[model samples]
Target: MVKRLTKHGNSLALVIDRGVLDLLEIDADTPLSMTTDGKCLIVTPVRDPERQKQFRAALEEGHRKYGKMLKRLAD
Candidate 1:
């Protein structure tokens, strides 16, 4: 979708749509990390370190639980 930057104080801002927000599992109060790759702008939610660790642990646990079934399917 095309978006135009609107003036806000001395800076410009692009409004994010609610659908996009829901897809990203973020809301207005979510902290975001914004960056550019020189070609495109990327915005993502910033995960707290503790939460990141917990998420990683959960992922590892899932991998262990499903590794055999996933490998069988991949074969």
Candidate 2:
């Protein structure tokens, strides 16, 4: 599907269709990252809530196991 870029403030914005949004599992408030890979543009959701929670838990576990070493290094 093709979407036209519409004027938003001083910039043009491409409005994504509902079907594409649903397929990508993204909502209005979803955080996104945009980058260019050579001639192509890549857009991705930043993180899923469950994945982020798991990541935080792992980070905390690492801190618990290596707290002293980390503190010593910082000093």
Candidate 3:
């Protein structure tokens, strides 16, 4: 989708669509990291490290608890 930057005070702002924001799980409170690969702009959420560690631990626990059942289901 094509978008034009809108005036925000003296700076410009890109108005992201609600659907896009929801799909990306981004909100007003989400901290974002912005960079440019020379030509294109890259925007990504800066994930919380502690939250990531918790998620990884939970995922590993789930796999350990359900690996056998999951393999059977896959077959």
Candidate 4:
């Protein structure tokens, strides 16, 4: 599907269609990454909130289990 960019304040925005939104399982607040691959613009959905929370919890657990060793190394 093609979309037109419209002026939004000082920036341009594209309105995504509902079908595409449903297929991507994304809402208006969903984070997106925009990059240029030489000639084309690449847009992708960023990490979901649940996955981010799980990763953070895992990192905290790892730190709790190995914090003393890390501190010793730092010293």
Highest lDDT: give the candidate number: 3
CA lDDT, every model vs. true structure: 0.94, 0.92, 0.97, 0.92
Q: Model 2 — TM-score against the truth?
A: 0.60
lDDT, candidate 4, equals 0.92
lDDT of 3 by residue, 1-75 (tens): 999999999999999999999999999999999999999999999999999999999999999999999999999
Q: Model 1 segments beyond 4 Å from truth?
A: 58-75
- Model 3: pairs clashing at backbone N, Cα or C within 3 Å: none
Candidate 2 has its poorest 10 consecutive residues by lDDT at: 40-49
Between 1 and 3, whose lDDT is larger?
Answer: 3
Clashing residue pair totals per candidate (backbone < 3 A): 0, 0, 0, 0
- Per-residue alpha-carbon lDDT of model 4 for 1-75, expressed as tens digits? 777899999999888889999999988898999999799888889977899999999999999999999999999
Q: Is candidate 3 or candidate 4 better by TM-score?
A: 3
Query: Candidate 2, clashing residue pairs?
Result: none
Q: Report the number of backbone clashes for model 2.
A: 0
By summed lDDT, the worst window of 10 consecutive residues in model 3 runs over: 20-29
Superposed model 2: Cα runs more than 4 Å off? 49-75
TM-score to native of every candidate shown: 0.67, 0.60, 0.67, 0.59
